[model samples]
Target: MTTAPTVRTSTPEERFVAAFELHEGHTLNGSNARIQGLRKDAIESFKQLGLPGRKDEAWKYTNIEKALRHEYRVLAGAPLDEVALENLAPFLVPGLEAHRVVLVNGRFVAALSHIGSLPEGVIVTGFAKASEAHADLVNTHFTRYADFTTDVFAALNTAFAQDGLFVYVPKNVIVETPIQVINLTTGDEDVLLNPRSLVVVEQSGSLKLVEGTHTLTEAKIFTNAVSEFFVGPNARVDHYLVEDEGANASRIHNLKAHQEADSYFSTSTITLSGDLVRNDLHFLPDAENCETHLFGLFLGKGRMHIDNHTLVDHAKPNCYSNELFKGVLDDASTGVFNGKVFVRPDAQQTNAYQSNKTIVLTEQAQMFSKPELEIYADDVKCSHGATTGQLEREAIFYLRSRGLTEERARTLLLLAFARDVLEQIKIDALREHLDARIAARFAN
Candidate 1:
């Protein structure tokens, strides 16, 4: 028997650092002197920490060393014409009045965005633009919600992010319409896209936001993204992330939310494409009676790999959290899930639950799942479970006995397994669209 080819090993830290240096000299008019200082500090921190390796517990299954061994060019001042924007208009959700914010190649495109009429005390704009238009708000909570010390990708995003979207919903105000953000990347050239988002919902306020990510070309590109959210007392917010990038691309997404007393937060992540993807979600319930829901669905085919890590921290009493994630792997793909729930000593009467289920369609496919619960409080209820298996042979044979083809029966069963999570999406139009997309994938 012949041996497998040896993979070359090289550090990507230098290449990423060089890219930051090239983008740092550019001029940003809205950013003040103090903001510049903070950016510099972030860059310094990123240089020291660098990219993680297999030894790191969080990144043990997902091997970054083998995935990011090549050098990527830094994108600067790329032209984003009107034609590119028009090509994406057909995919927009119909019959809904949405505030559209467009970002091309990690930079905001002002001409393509449609900032329609907004209610009073509601502010939505770019991060660089917020430096001048809303300096106090930007300064107070720029990198306050998420901890970038252990996350190298998040620090890299903060170092090179020149422009990003920022949304602030003031106290006692409700955003009637959803805010939609379209992040498109043309990876014709090898480069890295660092996108950032900061959202703050004041006390007793509510907001709903949806985001869609797509690619235009076929090239090896890296999209490192970070989103920070803060929910005040009694506030409610719903967030959704849809990934439809090309199969040749790779992405790392970090989402963190901080919830105060009596607040509610829900987030859903749907992954349909990408070669190697990792999603990290952290939720902190710092006060009493807070509620949180986390859901995810990922489909992996070919040689793709998808890794998801979620953590819920209970710091106070009487909080509840529930998490469910599902995955379907085909061909020679792989899937990884690591879900952890932590309850501190002061947190009493807390209820937390987590479950992960995966279905492998092919014998060559692989899956790894680990669900953990760490409870420090004596009076709490917590549980975790994980399951991985192939398609039920009896169910498939039953469908075949009804005169259905083998392929058709398998497709139907896969769709039935995924429909439960898809039904959880509240948006009618988006839900229907996603269902159609999943159906079409199986048909082909």
Candidate 2:
């Protein structure tokens, strides 16, 4: 039997690089120089920034120390399961002939993937393979949007980056079904998986993408994943990300999307469960006449903790953006929502809106919400709002008067509130599946 890698996190930042160096057969960023340089810079930045604590304004409410307080096998995992990949067939969107890309323990598994005939000019493969086949595209898009100078987690991920997912859609090609890129972390060992994906959609092209993160074992693990999307001019893209890790798992999901002129981009994040999950999503309309929408729904119970931080920057004029995030917290769970929108000086005629709503079921549950807007242009329409409270008494009374039990009425109201965001999903099959999942959560 292969011995488990013992990565002690009790020392936090002090032991990470030492542990990373001790891992056998581990090479930083492979043989690619661009990748090597990026990794070098990220490691240096991480050493300076270190791990952020509550003192940092952006991380004031969330306690990230728990992630570093334990030992994790950050370098290796046990052997792959022969049947694990086969069981993931249910994850494929129902009623659609979608291409499936699977990764186990952050390593791509080609034998388990299905790519039956793709649209012309579309490419999806593992990172190492993509780097060999489409070197130019990989050189251009890889690690472009990550500004590791500030975010330590981004820097750490870049430093430890390895084999992940790579996707490209050529100009004018419209993919019929969504592309599913999945990452599953098993209980082979107490490991930490670093998954990264680079997606580029060309001008006039359209595509739908869905990414999922799931756990299959009862081991303690951590996943630090980064995903970047580059939307070209006159293009359209819809992206949905879902994360459902084990009760003993911790994850840091970092997403950054850039939009070109006259392009349309929308993203919805659905986080169902986790021990400690922090999501950082940023949107930049870098050109004029662009449309961007951001939506998220998070549910937490027991000792689960969820933190969602989002930002939208309008760098050009005539851009429109809408942001909404909702959360349901019960037991001793903690929820945090912080959203910020910025309209640059030249971004006149920009229309931006932000709202966050939360429902706390018990007195032990806690929620912290902040919605902010900074406008440098005088002729922009911008608004922000945040509301946090329990279920409305009037609505509960009305439902009970209509012959529904109190518990049933509460469930119905909570489901109705959550469905508003779920209805925005453009894919019918995925929406229905998520609806059933939400219903099942409340059923428990």
Best by TM-score: 2
The lDDT, on a scale of 0 to 1, for candidate 1 is 0.83
TM-score for candidate 1:
0.93
The local distance difference test score of each candidate is 0.83, 0.83
Query: Lowest lDDT 10-mer window, candidate 1?
Result: 1-10
Query: For this target, which candidate reaches the highest lDDT against the unseen true structure?
Result: 2
Per-candidate TM vs. native? 0.93, 0.94
1-444 in candidate 2: lDDT tens per residue?
Answer: 125766543566666666555542355545476776777687788889999888987888887865666666565334666645557865666665578888877777898777667898799888767877788998888877867888788887877767778889999988878888777777566767777778899998998988888788888878888888899999999989887778978898899988999999999999888888889999899999999999899998999889999999999999999988998998899999999999999999999999999999899999999888999999999999999999999999999999999988888999998998999999888899888889878766
Off by over 4 Å in 1: 1-10, 27-30, 76-83, 94-97
C-alpha lDDT of candidate 2 relative to the true structure: 0.83
Q: Give the TM-score of candidate 2.
A: 0.94
Model 2, position 104, has a per-residue lDDT of 78
**Model 2 poorest 10 in a row by lDDT:** 22-31
